[model samples]
Target: MSVLIENMTIKRGMKKIIDNLDLSIMDGEVVALVAPNGTGKTTLLNGIAQLLPSTYKKLEINGFEPQLLNFKRSFFYLESSSNLFEYLNIKEHLLLIKKNWQSEIVLDEVFRLLKIYEYQTLPIRKMSLGMKQHALLATYLISDAPVLLFDEPLNGLDPGSIEITNGIIQNLADKNKSILFSSHDIANIQAICNRVVFLKDGKIERDTKNMDEILELYKQLYGG
Candidate 1:
């Protein structure tokens, strides 16, 4: 699956959140959207995913409009705090995810990989932030969606968790999944993404290879 955006813009009354942005991701690539807060990274993703209205734009996933794609079956969006059912135990969550995604064979494997097997019977509401994030990622893995979008996936994770997340994303990319994710973790971005799209004030500030060098140049450009 692939995604393409051309002249995409979003507005709220007088405010322009996304300004004439054009981006494209080929099949099976991991691309990172990097920016400071309030830069419309999430809004851009929302538009691409058809979670928000675009004023004037052309957005397509696999040659079809995002709104027309069978999102429930082919796409997964993982946000920072949307990990659980809030009322269900871990086992119930895993079981529901397995049933929803038809991934019974890998449910236990994902759980063990995430090291959440011991907490499988506990309520998700009682888990820590990192724990919940792990559970959420595990659910995504179980879903086996061809397109995965992540927002701030590295937040609140320890060093080991960060490494694990990076590895999981790399594995997904190797499996030919088209991935678009937003993050401020430059190290992780450099590790996983082949190219970078730098956003500022709702527009693309830079799109370049040599991500590490670009980050340093941008820092110098901003006198940081």
Candidate 2:
């Protein structure tokens, strides 16, 4: 149930984004990838999710090779945009995902968790950014997958929605779900994540194992 990356490297043309990266995420851990813009945070996530081809020497996820697990049913990735069905109503969009996944994932459960049930009838095109984020996140919660990859998790969320999102993430970690998420909000990282991994210049510059010390490190690194 853990993700292991050994000497992994990703290159795009002449630039090396993730170079000889080695890390391990234990089961049920809430991990955060932290960095400034263009630090390959998304690229590393893409590599872990197998969305992008990598030039690594070794990559293993849950004891299976990255390529094999990409084709398997155990991993799930939720982009920051949440890519909802723009033309479909919120409820219909959820229903469509449920139908395609054969009801293995539940919409109502997530609706209740996200408290988005009240706006279920609205069309996605008319929904606000926070609502769309909720809808996109709700789908992944319902999937009940082993590993969840999230990029720019709080991109469009307001303060209130952000609080709710934090609660959900904490709840997931409490439930022993393995979660990997990236965010620009260092405060959120301090509140919701157990550890913080900083990405810089295409490499993991720091991986803070102590949550209590993360704030100090963050302030020191980012110069708040």
Candidate 3:
């Protein structure tokens, strides 16, 4: 497994958001965490990325403990668009990550694929939500991390952009990277994710590789 979490617990003020949850994702697996809003999908990912205050009996990534440098290097996660520098352009941010991760992924290819060249030099302050989203995906591509976490990856994307993004994610899986993401788009999951895990009541209520009945399962479990 590339990520392992056991007996993990997280709380927000007085309420428990994640309660003794256990999750493990194997290499090359694409897992979708689905649930209604406020179900702690973001919290669980943040906890795994070590960005939140969490208590777990065991937590590790690719055999590296959460406190280790290797653990941090093993995953790429930038949840909020605010994490981007306001004054810098998308290319600048990509360059920074490329240098930091020492990634070999070609930036030219990324720019071309995401159609970022149109506004590659535009400052984050001036970019639209859709542009920022493209930049975010570009960063993940250049990070070259073994574990990648995404939240609502298809949100706000145009049809072409969604197609490209899905293709990229699928390519990454073909290369054996572990991907965990949260999304409300069921069709998107059926397109890329090999596994789906439903998060409810601060824990995974269902986990399965089968997607044939995803629609029925979703309505049955989530009352959609």
Candidate 4:
């Protein structure tokens, strides 16, 4: 397993968002955290990223704990485009990640892959929402981490960009990247994810490979 968390619980003040969750993700597998807002989707991602205080009887990334440098270097999680530096441009941001992660993926290749070549010089503050979203993905590609955590990877994207994002994610999975992403776009998730897991009572209520099941559950939960 690329990700393993057992008996995990996350609390915000007095409230437990995720309680005693036991989830494991395998390499080359794409899992969807399918749930409505405030259901610990982001909270789970945050806990895995160590951005929040989560207690786990066992929390590990390929045997390395989150506090370990090796574990930290193995995953890329960009919560949102808002985390982009307003002053830094795409090239600068990607360069920073590449250096930190020591990735071999060339900068120019990433530019062409994401078609972000022109945006390289433009500061993030000047970019549109869609452009910034691409910039965020650029960082993930540059990091070349084994585990990719995406929070709404398709947000603020045009149809064309959305297609590109989906293709890129699929290609990454083909290369054996363990991916976990959260999105309410049921149709989109049905397109790319290998499995869908939903939360109920702070635990995974369902982990199904059936896309039809996901659609049916989506309607029941979200009234689509």
TM-score of each: 0.88, 0.87, 0.96, 0.96
- Please give the TM-score that candidate 4 achieves against the real structure: 0.96
Residue 222 displacement (Å), model 4: 5.5
Model 1 CA deviation exceeding 4 Å by range: 98-105, 220-223
Model 1: how large is the Cα RMSD against the reference?
2.2
Compose the digit string of candidate 3's lDDT tens values, residues 60-133: 88779977877887899998676889899988998999888779989898898888888999999998888888
lDDT of 2 at 153: 80
lDDT tens digits by residue: candidate 2, 1-224 = 56777777889987888888887888889899887777788889888877787877666665677557233345567565446777777678667656554446567777888898789888788888888888778776766666778988887889988898888888877877788888877678878888788776667778987877776776677677
Model 2 alpha-carbon drift over 4 Å, by segment: 69-72, 99-105, 219-224
Off by over 4 Å in 3: none
For model 4, the run of ten residues with the poorest summed lDDT: 215-224
Number of backbone collisions per candidate, in order?
0, 0, 0, 0
**Candidate 4: stretches off by over 4 Å:** 221-224
RMSD of 4: 1.2
Clashes of 3: 0
Residue 76 of model 4 has an lDDT of: 89
Error of 1 at 150 (Å): 0.6
